[model samples]
Target: MIEIVRTSDLVLLGFLQSLLENANIPFFVADLHMSALEGMIGAFPRRVLVPADHVTQARRLIDEAGLKAELLS
Candidate 1:
């Protein structure tokens, strides 16, 4: 998996997840449980990961959404 974005913003995470889901790009949100365990204090940024094969497209979609700043690249 390629780590695309890591952020503390849960809303942005959900938005991106939905965007990718609608686009049919498989993805995983890493460290979610860990973040929850940490109490969502903006300590651990949750990661958005996609298969290596889908990284480029996913990045493009994120970038086009004006979320380039959120992308890990």
Candidate 2:
């Protein structure tokens, strides 16, 4: 899988998740459980990952949703 977006904003995460789900793109949110270790201080941002084959499509979808800035280079 390839990391597409990494963020500490839950709202943005939810929006990205919804965007991927609605588009039928498979994804995984990495480091989500780190919140417990970090005491919810947002020290570790969660990562949005998709299969390497889907990276391009996922990126395009996020970009089209006006979240291009949220994407990881």
Candidate 3:
């Protein structure tokens, strides 16, 4: 898997998830429950990951959606 977006925003995560789903791109969010362990202080930001085979297209879609800045370098 390739990490795409890493953020502490739950709303943004939900939006991104919907965006990827609508695009038919399979994805996983890592560290989703870490925030709870960290007392919801945003210390362990969640990560959005896509399969290695879908990385390029996923990145393109995210970029086209004006979320390029959210993607990992």
lDDT top scorer: 2
Order the candidates by lDDT, highest first: 2, 3, 1
lDDT per residue as tens, model 2, 1-73: 9999999998999999999999999999999899999999999999999999999999999999988999999
Give the TM-score of each candidate. 0.92, 0.96, 0.93
Assess candidate 3 and give its lDDT: 0.92
Task: For candidate 1, write residues 1-73 as lDDT tens digits.
Answer: 9899988899999999999999999999998898657876888988999999999999999999999988884
For model 3, where is the 10-residue window of minimal lDDT? 35-44
| Predicted candidate 3 versus true structure: per-residue lDDT over 1-73, tens digit per residue | 9998999999989999998999999999999989768998998889999999999999998899899999898
Candidate 1 all-Cα RMSD = 1.0
The parts of candidate 1 lying over 4 Å away from their true place are none
Give the Cα error of residue 64 in candidate 3, in Å: 0.8
Candidate number with the higher lDDT (2 or 3): 2
Task: Flag the better candidate by TM-score, 1 or 2.
Answer: 2
Candidate 2, after superposition: displacement of residue 21 in Å? 0.6
The lDDT per prediction is: 0.91, 0.95, 0.92
2 or 3, greater by TM-score: 2
